[model samples]
Target: MSATASFLARRAAQKERVRILYRRALKDTLNWAVHRHLFYEDADRLRERFEANKHVEDLETVERMIADGEATYNKWRHPDPYIVPWAPGGTKFTRNPTPPSGIFIEKERKI
Candidate 1:
């Protein structure tokens, strides 16, 4: 029973990694694609690569493939990935954070 649970937990983690990798790869692809139509084409090709491996029933193979994909992504990742202005590490992040309410500091008057 413990073995089955361990296998399932590991499998779930691997699946999550694959999802993250795919999203990162897709976004990185967008960084390189200068036009929307080209991005769409790249996205479709990316989906096909994932779908091609969807039928593998072997857990070990799946694990290996996920690892390989992650390595590839990290190796060729964008040097400066695009970030939304309001997101963390973005230009507008915390740009104008709201001040705490009801706290006022009066400037000291100079003589």
Candidate 2:
């Protein structure tokens, strides 16, 4: 690939990585907010923070910002992340047995 093409590819990948990081951070924030209203405010703040960097044109600065953001996320991550009751990582799912209570499977009949 030409130099310009390679740089563009790397930049695209960096953007994608930043996008994924932002999503994970947003979800993690839910673990810290007890009420839905509080969560909306937290989510808005998070969106603003990410949007503030949307106009950045310097690749190096973007990389630095992403690294800093990731570091901050790691530093403040919830010790006990809140998982939805039906989610794989949550207690309701992890501690429950397979098939659950009301699920039914009808056997296929051979024609």
Candidate 3:
């Protein structure tokens, strides 16, 4: 195989591994949350961290952290408000520029 093909294949495999780790971590987080409220308290922080670091190329390293017991779901909550999400792959958080108007807003406003 050409070097480019090899690189692409490796990248694909890496991404798949990352996805697996992500799913496992998500499952662990959910399980922990179900068992105790501490995990629930950290949900937002965990989501933010995962969203931030989700696209790192060295997925194995991150996976190791998740598997190593150091990345417990509760670790998401520490000091002050919370840790910021990393915005993985250099993606920015795009807020909705404008709110939806008219009927939907009016109907909800009644409650």
lDDT of 1: 0.90
- Model 1 regions more than 4 Å off: 100-111
TM-score of every candidate: 0.78, 0.78, 0.41
In candidate 3, residue 52 scores what lDDT? Answer: 79
Instruction: State the lDDT of candidate 3 residue by residue for 4-99, as single tens digits.
Output: 797778778766765665565565556545455766665666577668766666645755755553445346522333223444322343433356
User: Mind giving the per-residue lDDT tens digits that candidate 1 earns over 1-111?
Assistant: 999998889888888988988998999999988899999998999999999998886889998999899888889888988899999999999999877899886889999
Measured over all alpha carbons after superposition, the RMSD of each candidate to the real structure, in angstroms, is: 4.9, 6.0, 13.5
**After aligning candidate 2 to the native by TM-score, how far in Å is the CA of 97 from where it should be?**
4.8
In candidate 2 the C-alpha lDDT for residue 23 amounts to 91
Candidate 3 regions with alpha-carbon error over 4 angstroms: 35-43, 54-111
Please give the distance, in angstroms, between residue 20's alpha carbon in candidate 1 and its true position after superposition.
1.6
Q: What is the lDDT of residue 25 in candidate 1?
A: 94
What C-alpha lDDT, on a 0 to 100 scale, does residue 64 get in candidate 2?
A: 95
lDDT of 2 by residue, 1-111 (tens): 698998898799899989999999999989899998999999999999999889997888999999999999999999999778878976687574678679997899999
Clashes of each: 0, 0, 2
